[model samples]
Target: MHDLIASPFLNSFVVLRPGRLEGIALPERRFRELAQSHGSGLAVPLWLTDAARSRWGIDVAPRPVSHAVHIRDAPVYGHSRASWEINLGCDLDCEHCYLGEKRFAGLDAEGKQRLLLILRDAGVLWLQITGGEALINPHFAASCRLAHDLGMMVEVLTNGTRLTSPTILESLTTSRPYRVTVSLYGATAETYDSFTRRRGAFRRVTRGLAAGVEAGLPLRLALIVTAQNAHENDRMRGMADELGIPYKEYTHMSPTIYGGAESLASQSPAHLKALERFTGCNAGHTFLHVDPHGRASMCKVGRDEQIDLMAEGVEGLVRLGAIADRLMLRTGGCSGCRLSGLCSVCRPLAKRYQEAKAPLNTYCQHEQKGDSG
Candidate 1:
């Protein structure tokens, strides 16, 4: 997959041209099928051709040109930090939402201000606004403008219910969001409506998507996976394909310890484990969730989210973020396990392990079941 001749052009020292890529493992048959399907298996990024890269304004290749141990020694296409959730108060009672209904039940005014201040001062280059529904917040537009003014691109993740207005569109469009991610529950009304429990919500989400597309805004899709709907992941993903929106699927993984999916958190361990393989707790590194109560966690689940940002303040928390980096680099347990593409213990899960001596993982159990079969 990596060729030495291609290293100089694509290595850490030299930046890969926006659209140019030198190393890719597309040489395999199975991988080729995946490429023609699921985007080159995350190994090869679906990239624009060389000429197209010039227009897209990106220099990072979707695939690596080299196999460097250190990211510093490897090529980087994006910024160092990631877009994190600062607000959690939401109005919708989404059955599969990671931000449980209680979290978004409401937000204290003081807590909101504290989070905004933290994001603004953290040298954060990209800020994402999410909530029960970020757009519903009274000061949503003003807040978006504030973040945009700070020389950072603002990204919004919403249910698309409140964005059905001209003014809302204007405010968001003016901000030039990195992308507006809309959750697509199902391809059909019956399927989607049943899950959201909002009769006309499916229609509204579709309409909002059309308006966003017409406005030339980028769109991403979030598909929730539950026991009732787990078998339909591929089907929902196909819907995103039809809509031309990149989609990701998430299972309501509360595991009891982290307020998992209300009634089904205790789904068979085997099923939970399968999701864990791909949906492993990437909390500390991949995401940093902020709740309405001003609680913070690298991941949404895990009781250790006891890390209160309102108490620590932004300075202390930014410093603490390095802990996530350390936790990610760790190579043990699920994290350290040498399974190909298995989910490891995210920060939240690690906290669980420390707090409770029990190993109640679905992934491990699922694999064991397969062995028995």
Candidate 2:
């Protein structure tokens, strides 16, 4: 990765460092000047050199623009963020996975590279690479490196089971992700292993966590509270505390993305937290999601309409905003509901619950409505 990444983020321009959360915004003229300077073999600007020294404690003196800065081209699309499921495969089988069936399949190395370039060209500044477990994918490291080199800050979502692998650790520490979020199932070995149905899972995860912390990775914990592991919620918090890392708890459960209700069986009834009121969101307007097979959707929960990226390329994204609008309409079971305004989830998510025939109380506040399908 270059020392700094300069790129256009929708209407604005930004400079970011890999693995760092902080960023510097630049005016359009200044950004264009840098681009021109790089093209003309001019020296790096003093302002950027000073900004690097003060903000990140790095001295970039007398370096050419081509060497010190990597600039990205502006995109036709206004999108600035996206999430891609690199592969829908995991090492452990958790009881409440939203993916439902975790199959090992996705694009090949060349296809993956093409997709990343498409995302870069689409002006995706922040990209989340996820999976059944992102680390298990053979092309994950290469993808991460390519994304960083292309001026996008990457975040990886993993289960922490493979953090102990020297190869995985070296790859991440070298290229570095802005964040690596790991799922925390339980505090104890028995509870964790039981929940995931994977023997020795807790041991491997703990070791991986230690390795990540020691390597000074930007790590966060996602505490997954379910019926099998709800009793250990407090202990799980303590575990995150002991590691000196930040964490967030997930008490509510949703049906599988494919509208399968099987994953809901693990919901902890007593521990379910009230969801925040649903306001508006930008879903397909400013962000998009891509499945393992290079299918792009509005978001993870609202995937009724998808564009096959491998088939149509980034040009396929042109129709996504319209799809988002259609999916948001209150039709079908939600048509003319008295309490539609107070619903906590968007239409696409509520549709999934309805398809799964989930308990009304699990998602809806109103009493029984006949034939929601």
Candidate 3:
């Protein structure tokens, strides 16, 4: 069997033939030299190599390894990273929930397993099992095990409410998710419960995070910013720090996927611009999000345009690609605009403005300055 190791520092993968361990983190020049001398292997990204190995096992050699690099730059349909919302029945009813009050009806266990197999066949190496609360789904652990057994790396997104249960904790241990990200709404119980509208949820979530940490699972903390808990952001960071876990903060808020204008306040313009500069939607290109019912879209915000995964199976990816291409087009006032470079307004948000006939000023500072051509 060919041995492969991933180097996060280099953002590359090293291929070895059994006993070729010259140590890890080799410099690029030395790595290239080794690849040249080895004749059978080449340098490639971990995601590409992992996908290949997962799909084809040892039978797939490292020939023309350079092609893998383009997987991120120019993804091939059906061969990219994916996230599936195993179930949308989240326990928390936060005001900023993008899904709104929509009831979730997902595939049965047999059908979900079938979907995983289809994704595995389609070359999806990285899969995230998320939910209203993934742990709340009876089949979540089974799904994680299935993804892992299929050679896909699994990540779980949860609010941490149900994670403290003994049964759930045991299931998580067995399924062995690569990482578990807990959403921290507030640093204190009062703010958190107020945001979720569920009393005692904060205590439960914190306990769940502690349980995962005690179980030796890789844990990450994410703080969801909203008008209600904006003041608690720093305290939440401090809480994550106290827990000794990596933390991320996000401020973007959108109307519900069902187009409900619940109308919570949004982040400030300066904050939005700074955040947008660093983030871009990767939807159809290299990433896809699947809802509980198996509807696949480029991203959460782009859910309006979707392909029913159960109906199309692997071929759904092609339809999604076509949809993404159309969606990526610059429409309305955005087309031929000189400030498009500085504008953080993406295609999906722009489409929202076009449909609502709202001025771009609502979404873009540049547009507010009359920069649109």
lDDT per residue for candidate 1 within 254-313, as digits (tens), equals 433443435344233333423434444334443455655556555445334245767776
TM-score for each model: 0.61, 0.96, 0.76
Q: What does the lDDT come to for candidate 3?
A: 0.68
Query: Residues 1-373, candidate 2, lDDT per residue (tens digit)?
Result: 3788889887789988889989999999989999998877788899999999988898767888888889988889877899999999898999799999999999999999999998987789899999989998999889998998888899999999999988899889988999999999999999999999999999999999999999999999999999999999999999999999899999888899999999999999899888876776888978999999899999999999899988998888899999999998888888878777778888898999999999898888685344343
* Full candidate order by lDDT, most accurate first: 2, 3, 1
Q: Please state the error at residue 88 of candidate 1 in Å.
A: 3.4
Better of 2 and 3 by TM-score: 2
Q: Give the Å error, residue 241, model 1.
A: 3.9
Error of 3 at 360 (Å): 4.8
lDDT of each: 0.52, 0.90, 0.68
Q: What is residue 283's positional error in candidate 2, in angstroms? A: 1.3
Q: Which 10 residues in a row give candidate 2 its minimum summed lDDT?
A: 364-373
Weakest ten-residue segment in model 1 by summed lDDT: 68-77
- Highest-scoring model, TM-score: 2
